[model samples]
Target: MPTPSVRRSRPAAVRDRRAAASRPARREPLSTKQVIGLILGGIAFLLPLVLDVPDLDDMGERMLAIFLLAIVLWVTEAIPLVATAVLVIGLEVLLVSNQALLPVPEDATAYSTFLGALANPVIILFLGGFLIADGAAKYHLDKNLAAVLIKPFTGSARTTVLGLMVITALLSMFMSNTATTATMFAVIIPILGALPSGKPRTGLALSIPVAANVGGIGTPVGTPPNAIALGALAERGYHISFASWMVMAVPLMLVILIGAWLLLIALFIPNGLGIELDMKASWATDRKAVTFYVIADCVILAWMTESLHGINANVVGFLAVVALLVTKVMGGEDLGRLSWPVLWLVAGGIALGDGVGATGLDAWILSLFNWGAMPALVVVIVMGALGLGMSNVISHSAASNLLIPLAMGLATGIDGLEPVTIAVVLALACSLGMSLPISTPPNAIAYATGEVTTADMTKVGIVVGVIGTVLLVLFMPSIWGALGLL
Candidate 1:
């Protein structure tokens, strides 16, 4: 006795589900949007190759054009991330024929752009550190800490968020952003599952992801983008020490964590969730556990900054994960659990950014923007926006890799501006984790929890992203300028 409307809707719903789950056929059916982008990409590809265009004659111009095309792919979400990496690398190194990109003086190697970027110690350190983070999860240290921290705060959603952020921040200081995120996800799933299935529970469940995003700001290893920024800074001769980074890092993370916690309190629980914490089990922290955590962290820090021979940071980190897991210091399953997607994405980001730099594209793009004449404050704002905006489009590590070099190039061009100071702003902005689910690993991690929709995350991001950026723009001059970077 179903109505005509109900009968029709059922068939259509089933068909839609089938279409969504269908794998890409050997001959993929192109969407209207994809078709349009493909056409545009084709024109762009051919224009430089066939016409021998004057602007294209310069390597810089062509590189900028290609970067813009990558942006196009980013906007449309048409290509896989790795596919963009391949396209960018091939176009920048192999295809480029302009003499300017390959000027014979000083730097001359056939596969310079391609091979040179990979040879960078900073990139190596980043990859190595990520591998270490994967190893950390193989031991259950991350989960133990997460449980120890949040178990006491289960009474309210705000507490859960604050607890998660604090723990994640601490773990990230030693682990990769991706690994930190995965570990945190495992911890939260249990608590969220325990919540009463309703609107209040839903809001609280969403808060844990927000905590993770905020938590990522606390340390260098907390996220890959920060690691890339720091690694690149070291390689570029900035000499930013571990102690120096913490001064800015601690305050930045605290500001976001506390602010978000307050916001959650206001929005989700006016009177509070009225929940209780398990004090006997959670409050009982073993000093031995703390010692292990501290020792593990210091070792990673040494590996990151100090030369330990041919052993890379990733190797050291993974070994630490193994030590912890095998020794039963942390639970075994946690170390084995890691996110492969993030690891590959970061690698692709490294390739993409290196390709851009290798082409001298960043230098040329800076020329086109013409921001050298602007005031110091104006320059900072523009650069922050550029970094944050670009980060929104792709991964944060890629943004840092691109912007760090751009900042270096533009620093001298602008009057009396310290390059590292500007670079720090860009670096910090790289992991701001606001604006979109795609913005950062932490944001993406939070988005994937299903407690928060894209719209909800976006709303939170718009407000917090603005606040976070302003904090950097305002804080950097005082902090870095005091230290004389400005």
Candidate 2:
């Protein structure tokens, strides 16, 4: 009895119902936290226009507001971190670069001013690091390396814990900490499951993240925060060679790693000391893998001898990229798997720092601080403490990004405080906040295994973070002075 139109409408309605049934439900509206972030961001944008600080010019005031807003958003994570990064670039383009607003003479266009951050040499260094990591992963190089490093001491539980910690640390020095933790996580689950549920099982699990976090400090490419600090220092005409960084970082990491091992033994002593792990190196004879290893070693050798070769670290990274592709050790897909989001995040930080320098914001901020009166050691402790705290709450790279410019600003104000030293301290401190699962990727990865709880991590993290900071404070001055950095 229905007309053709009615029949068509009925079928369409039925199809719509079926489609809706298959799809997920509508998500809830903005959370209270997100709404609060929006409000704070709005306030931050508007505050500088009203109450102007003495040292801050109109543009400096506006940039400060934006920076504060960014800090709030980053800490709260109301939006994606990448989105906040984009917001930083966008806001700088509008608020700082706009001719009607606070335009600078150097900026030909707003886009050009901020866009160049994506191609920063430090960023390129990261690109090379990513390629190497991907290639290593694709070729099972990390696993093989881990197997070789951990194979020797699989006899006793205490020795096994040490071996796992050492292997995780060593692998993290070259690959992504998250990847290293995940790789080691699978290796240890069976061993952990074999043991009774108690402190020892928990301690072994906790060691992976602590070691990974500590180990990342050992290499520039080990983590994004390291690259951020290195790049910022380079921009200020201070450069630490790849080998030079390891010279300082490796010794510190070894000390902390051993301390962590002892703490685990003391706090969570294993009942059985006879658990054997099958750590025999696999893929021993793969020619392609060997080729990858050889190329990587060659690149590392060049990096370590940068004093003799005088090749820039980023250039070495590029060479590694070319060598890997030419040798067919890495394919196009492997390159595609690199952490583009993280790169974007770092690029945003670079852009923000560049803006700070270009716009005189750094000078204005430095003027407000009375650093001349403050002790240099106290300054280091404060910065280190702040870096450690911020990294625990937000992304480590984000924390580093926020602190490095401030540290540099402090360096300008504080007589006899080396900018490079402050930068190094800030970067190292960023890695020290491993007390919470959210502090770093490696921590989260281990926590995901359910063998370790948040309480377990928090307890270990607090001690490790505090001790690490204290040690850096004690040794960094002499170390940097020896390197002619102070």
Candidate 3:
């Protein structure tokens, strides 16, 4: 008798998943940097016990201490972001709610005051975004979308470059800019590689990073910084809906992209190279993909028509997540695929926002600035400049985490300035960094292609960055004012 056929083993990804789930959770020992973070955190926690700020209540001082510790850990990332988030919860409960350290008031519950941030509406909004983005990826929707969009600009090098940038921007609005850049990088190289070495090749390569950076400004879920700003403002009762954000940011992005395109043409790339671009379409009527499309479209529509629909953005977001799960567009394993660290990072920021309000730190910090006489436009320019600089050095989300609180504080004394507007501008400005490969993931991705040099990036980056900043400074106040956001 023939031997029975042996069943094939599960794929590596599946095996890894089962192994991960079955293994007991391990507590990894801290590294040297993490130990340093702990030391710093301990000092921050103890300082309030030793010294006090004038006019700050006991609770305020303690909260500020935790805030300081969080700032250090977050900036350094000495520990995992989720670990920092868990630490934030634990510290707040121990310091803020424990009667042994401080009296618990009738209005505050440790469970209620601190843990609420974990379930914040903004977090749910991102949850929805994550699910939708995951579904898009699972179906290769972004790639298909790009293939169709790039067909039009196949003839002219400048238009081809612009078209590529446009597609990159659109994809970045929903997908992570990093993922978008990586995906498009593959498509761009084959087309440009055939051409002789020249400016058009360099120009095409440069457009991906520039466009990816600018594209993220178009939506709340487009980048972590946007979510951070939205979550912080929402905590303060300033609601910036999905539609409102897109209305303000999309126009700004378009103008900036136009300026960037012009700068690219003038500086590096020549026109009319006649590159023949042909991207094959893949999504026509695949059942699973079509289901995903319908669900995603409806969710986005509801989010945009929020005023008419009366459904909260968070609710809409959660609905999308549910729909994805119910349709099996994403599975339990897919949950592992999501960027949980980013979500945790945002949670840390929300907790910090909570701490800011509880400790009266926001008001106290505001007191330090004499912004009563500063023009709102100057405030925009200064804040935008600060954001641009900080983002180049750290994660844009970290930049937003540091800057949004200060922006909120500044908003109080500056007449005609809205906290929401400051939050929006700061988030947008964080995406304007492109001078160095270190500035953003997209820039680093482009640099990795070996097509563009650091000097090449810097020369073009400076011009584009300046153009973006000026456009933002010129347009932000007017747009916000017109929208009655100021």
TM-score, one value per model: 0.75, 0.90, 0.86
**Residue 196 of candidate 2: its Cα lDDT?**
70
| Candidate 1, 1-486: lDDT as tens digits | 976654558889899889988966587778887777777776665565445544333454565666666665644546755466456655666445323344433342245544444444444444444545554454456565566666776766566666766776677665665556677677667566666565445455455555555556555556656655654455456655444566666777788767766766565544655555442323324654554555467656666564445454544555655555565655545434544444444444445555456556666667777676688788888778877778776776566655665676677678867766776777777666466777766667766776766776676666666788888887757776676533
Q: Which ten-residue region of model 3 has the weakest summed lDDT?
A: 98-107
Candidate lDDT values, in order: 0.61, 0.83, 0.80
lDDT of 2 at 125: 84
Error of 1 at 294 (Å): 9.3
Residue by residue across 1-486, what tens digits does model 3's lDDT show?
Answer: 999986656797688899999999998888887788778877876787679787777777777787777767765667765677678777787777643256756654455666777777888888888878777777888778888888888777778888989999988887778878988887787877866686767778899989988998998888888988998888778888788888889999998888888888787666556777767978858778789899999998898898897898989998888888888877788888888877877877777777777667778766666667689878888899988887776678777877787788777778767787788888888888788887888989888877788988988777777778777877776877887655
Better candidate by TM-score, 1 or 3: 3
Off by over 4 Å in 2: 1-29, 50-53, 98-113, 284-287, 483-485
Query: Candidate 2 on 1-486: residue-level lDDT in tens?
Result: 976664568889899999999999998788898889888877876787678677777777777877888887887777888888878888788777744355555642465767777788888888888888777777777777777887777777888899989999988888878888888887788889766787778888898999999989999989888988888888788888898888878988999999999998888865456777776666745778889888888887888899898999889998888888888878787778889888888888877787787667888776677767898888888899999988888889889878898788788777777887888889999999888989988888888878888988999999988998899987867876887645
Best by lDDT: 2
For model 1, the stretches where C-alpha displacement exceeds 4 angstroms are: 1-36, 49-57, 96-113, 151-157, 193-199, 231-235, 277-298, 301-360, 398-404, 440-450, 484-486
Q: List the residue pairs that clash in candidate 2.
A: none
Residue 206 accuracy (lDDT) in model 1 = 50
